[model samples]
Target: MMTKLRKIILIPALTIVSLSGFFSCGVDRWPEYAHQTALDTWILDIMQQNYLWYQELPSYDDVNLFVEPASFLSKVKSKQDSYSFVDSVMATPLPTYGFDYSLVRNPDIDTAYNALITYVIPGSPAAQAGLERGDWIMKVDTSYISKKYETYLLQGTKAVELTLGEWKEVEIEDEEDGNEGGDGEDEGPTMEYRVVPIDEPVEMPAARIVEDNPVHKYEIIESPVKNIKVGYLMYNSFTAGTKAEPEKYNNELRSVSQKFKEAGVQAVILDLRYNEGGSMDCVQLLGTILTSADRLGEPMAYLEYNDKNTDKDATILFGTDREINLDLHSLIAITSGTTMGAPEMLIRSLFLEDVYPIATVGSSTKGQNVATEQFINEEFLWSVNPVVCTVYNSQHDTYGAISPATDLKVSETTIDGSTNYSEFLPFGTFDKDGKSERLLKIAIGVLDGTYPPKDDKTPEESATQTHFKVEKSVSSPASRRFSSKGLRL
Candidate 1:
């Protein structure tokens, strides 16, 4: 999944200084155009010929030609086009030198956003400075940060100071009910912050790991019916070996597959509940591992580009050469509205294969059957990620969202030390307590044929199912393992 704290750096500093002058550009090589109008012109030009939803794009005269690039993309973007988007790298680029935090509106402070240090990349400046997950970000520098300035705080730079804080809760009066314990108006609940001191700014190293240190965790449990063994894997993102960070993701996947094999699992529960897509290579590799051996070396899916680039379209294949294979006949997927990109692609592709059936249990899927390629100008100053193709399954089916076979929304839970703010269980901890997690319970029922009984679903059970009280704008592909499906210079 594209984390608020990425394992990779998508955008680097662009110091180019040109706009009107012609660029040494080709069909895909755009110039480092600096002016808003020229950049928009370039973006619109690219999208017009390349975007999968190019036909849906607004006319140049219909939208502002010189607004922020991100805003311009948003304005012309089709509501149906949920996956295609411009990252900050091409628009308002953020830095990566300091710690990474997922900032959300502070429920207590209207003006401030609560920050969580999701995870710290080891050996990075943030780790060297003693930063890690479960740390509350108290302040950026001098004051508590506002949501508007979140991008500014996360930019990649040579040096940036951070003020980490501790979590604290205070009591305040309950105004909605107009009632207090024994008094008319007393404190009920409030979140207060204690400032952290930063005497100086910290300098950072030259490079950062660009691909996701993918969060892959798996566990094994016995099925209630027939004593079948099942494997549960929580996959956060799909990534493969990159030149800069070779085997970072593929290796993790292989390792997890090995665990499932060693455990003698008869069935596998692929948990993509939070994954935003990543590398196509990694996605296909995992699919290969999940499918049976007879299906290998056969056409799995096809990638079709626009008419202009028929040469670029090609058939995807399933293979049997992986270190280990589950050889699963059917996969039980735990998904959510957040399930997207390659994850969606895998589900649809497997369903089309007919050999390896896919049964999903989660909320509605985030239909984003689009794949984007990152293009950088000859100067390497500006980059653009435009939709290039629409993925089709083995049956030549195209889609936006793939509804779950069984829609069971399971809310995340907080253990003793971990809070819902971050579902922390050390990735893949085997709960020796023999108690199944909420989602696992339902998936187990599905495996054992005990799901969907008349009384199986109740108001109390439905309440415990996963839900977000706060509204989140549907996440875009830019956040999913920010990557390209093609090779780049």
Candidate 2:
């Protein structure tokens, strides 16, 4: 009996040893590469530790992971000492509410507080009561609207009665006196009208015609010098639809381009002044269409990574699986302090190729050149800011740094139409006088050959030709003196 029991235990022990050996061999065969240098090891170590804070945070598996070996290694070198890496990785938008409203002001009633327009829809109670733009709204049932803040409560579709303090309708009245031929002076009679709230289409700016279709609203302003027309295409955001959907934005852009071509426009000015940024593919597509063929194959940008953790061994990855060749010569992008994300990419690509940046105002770029791939699971959405590729200019400068070809300092007055030019400085402290305007004028000058060449003029002449001086404002105790251009007191 002892011998039989020994055999049974031995058989199972041998089987377990065989299974362990098989698994160990298989694991050894699996590919595992180590870092080349101690610096690389250290970077990986830090990234792994930092990643733990976000591991349990959430895991999203919607999209496949994309790694660019070159960009990964480049970033590791460039951002070794920058604090922005940590801040950028942690930045997130907090949840918040968004509200939309329209306001109409009235000047007539003592209790004008009650003259708030509520539920004013066409063919509804308000429209039926003859309430229109500039009509004095007195009362919404029993509520009073003294301050603008009170109008927030009347947002949804709800019926409410209103009372008008007074309404004036301009009309001609006949004089009871028979002496009609004598005095020519006549005052119009005023009438009162009331209305209730109802749903109506809000009137908005009409979309202008580009090509044959009415699309992308734009303005064609004549250049200060003749024969050149500046076509301003104000693109707002690129978030129109997903990748699978047809690109409506491209359609609009094509239409705009066709119109520009038809109008014999010599140079186009793409105003990305307030653009925050959106889809990368959209930007790329637009670049393809706008750039010339000669500017296509040159290096557009270089990507840098903080850690060299990619398994791929290639230096350059192009297209899909490194198959797509990017064409970069199609656009001249305008950047401002407000330009960020993919918009920065567009500008950086142009800058790398030595394309004309035209005019950049406001502040320096936000400097977030890394790409992100988003993942979504049942529980949460995970957006991983991965250093996929280092965007390099033709010279292979990686760290996506954007110094304006011509820097312009933008102030609030610039956007409000009060200032003609921005100062060409980073911060608002330095005054550029008309430097911003000069840069734009020079860009136009380059295309037209009207601007004086640097070789033809002395340094002082070049400086004088580009600079415009504004008189300094005098400061007083109560208020500062304003410019005489009537830019408002």
Tens-place lDDT digits, model 2, residues 1-489: 112111111101111223244356458521222211222333334444332122322122221112222233334433332221211111222111111112333323333342322112223333445554223334445655545434332322244454554322223344577756777664445332222333432222211211111122354545555556555565645443323444555566666666666665655556554455555555655454454445554444444432443342112212221112222223334456556665666655555334443344334665655543322111111112223333443345544434454323433223223221232211112112333333344444444456445475433321112211221111111011000110000
Q: What tens-digit string does per-residue lDDT give for candidate 1 at 1-489?
A: 234643333332344533333444533233333343666677788888887677888888676665656667888877876556654343322334434445555655677765666444545666676665545565655557675765555543445566665443333443575454656563445532322333443433533443235544577878766688888887777766555666776887788789888888878888787687877787778878887777777777788887777888978887767557787887788887778788888877777444666777767678887788776643324556777887877677787676665444444443222234333223333343453455666777777877655564443332122221332122212223444446210
- Model 2 TM: 0.42
Residue 13 local lDDT, model 2: 14
- Assess every candidate by TM-score: 0.65, 0.42
Worst 10 residues of 1 by lDDT: 463-472
For model 2 the local lDDT of residue 44 reads 36
Listed per model in order, the count of residue pairs whose N, CA or C atoms clash below 3 Å is: 20, 36
